[model samples]
Target: MIEQLGPPTLFFTLSSANTKWPDLHKLFPKTQSNTVHHNRMQFIENLVNNPHITTLYLHLRFQIFRDEVIVKQLHATDHWYRYEWQHRGSAHIHGFLWLPQAPNIDNLDSSNHESIQSVKNLFDQYITTWNPRTEVDHLNKQYIPAISNPCLSNTGVISRSEPCTDYTELVNVVQCHMKCLEYTCLKKNSTLKCRYKAHWPEQHDSSLTLDHNNNPSYKPARNDSRLNVHNPMMLAIWRANVDCQAICSKKAILQYISKYVSKTEHKSESYIDILKRIVGLINSEDTILLAYHRFMMGIVADRDISTQETCHMLLKLPLISCTRQFVNLNVGKKIFQL
Candidate 1:
């Protein structure tokens, strides 16, 4: 698609499993226990017991996003998306969108100030890292109670009548986008640096700059360096952690997307050692059926199946969705025939 349609306009990731969502909480039986630990355990138990509900909810949310946001809002000409399960059994989506009208960084001239400004304007229209709380406080000049789980709060919902409704929702949802120094983001055996290269210096105005490889990069104006890029409308509706960014370097972004979507299952060193031992045990005298059974057992033993993924498979849900269909074209065969 990149060869035919140029480069995608945006790349996004949507994560699921908001434990504090009112609808998800309602799935559990009414409990008198108000303790945080007890509620958390109960939620986990419910998820294990009812995996279908979790997967179905995720699928439904993705459908809504595809229809409303991608098609209607962004007016994407074409798109591709894939669903993957996290280590903890939750589901998330990785997607790419091709917008005909959006500026393509690959075609932009870095030296042209007008061209750079146009790209920045398009970025500011959808992506933002600024916190809405700063604007709210500037206008209200009062303190609002901090909401840990904004999805459960009534004020988190955007309303036309309430002037601060959108601001409150933006403030609460943006809080979820804050970047933390977790093990996943940190360099192996090192606590000082982030693996994803986050925590960029604060920029007062959005600008386009060339990366180390001389590829055009768009940097959104940000007040808080710890926050991730997000779309305010998406945050208000999805009410979960979301990452939205413009596709800057076509080669680099395509490489990343391909690697991420085709990533294989993570296997531990112990699992590899066990598989090798099982392979070594196969003997020439052993019956074909018995050897096959033993090998199958070894493979099954090494497999990691999460409750949500199992439920998704049993329900016969598709692992991917795309606006266009693809077919293999054998150019080598045509060349030989000619």
Candidate 2:
């Protein structure tokens, strides 16, 4: 596909927050006799017991996103995506989109300022790191009354006239996009460093520049360096954290994404040794049923399966989806035409 179509225009990740979604919370029955704390616990319990609900919700939301954003807004000519489960059992999608009109990084001339600026303009059109909190701060400096979360209402109604409605939605729902120090980012190297490089340098203006490796990199004008780049409208509609990045280096980005999408189940060295021993114990004289049982035991040992993942598989949901049909060509075989 890469040989035929070149690299994808954008590489993105969309994450799901099952607990944070009000729609998912509402799925549980409300009881007058239950206290607020009790109701919250019950709701969590329901989610744990019925993992399929959240899995299905994630699938449905992704479908809506594909139709509304990918097809309508971006007009992606080709795309591919895969779903993966997080440690906490939440589902997330990693995808690549090919936009026919997007500028090809491979063809970009770094020496030409006009060309670089044009590419930056196109990137800024779809992705941004602007936070609405800056606007609130500006208003407060001018002695305007402080605005609160617009979605927080007992009646569950937001006035369209409310000035902070959009701001509140972006800040509240996309909270996860904010970078913070965690185990995942903390690398245990000689000198500990953040794997995500969360401390992005503040840029006064958006610019398309070359990185240390001479790979084209687009840095959007950012007041809050901690906030990840995202599409504002898409973030609002999805009501979750999302990351959008330009494919600066075709080979690098493809290799990175391919590693993630093709990753196998993680197995420790000790587990591998055990599996090898189990295989060794199975002799040719052994019955097929006995050998199969031994092999299954070895494979199952130390394998962790989250409830959500189990539900995802049991429900027969697709883990991968692509817009274009692919055909396999055997380069090793000789073709003879009669």
Q: What tens digits encode model 1's per-residue C-alpha lDDT throughout 265-331?
A: 8663365675566566667786878656655545543447677888888999988878777898887
lDDT (CA) per prediction: 0.69, 0.68
Minimal lDDT window, size 10, model 2: 146-155
Regions of model 1 farther than 4 Å from truth: 25-38, 135-145, 154-184, 189-191, 268-303, 330-338
**Any idea what lDDT model 1 has?**
0.69
TM per model? 0.75, 0.75
Backbone collisions counted per model: 0, 0
> Over all chains combined, what TM-score does candidate 2 have?
0.75
| Candidate 1 lDDT score at position 230 | 75
- Candidate 2 lDDT score at position 24: 63
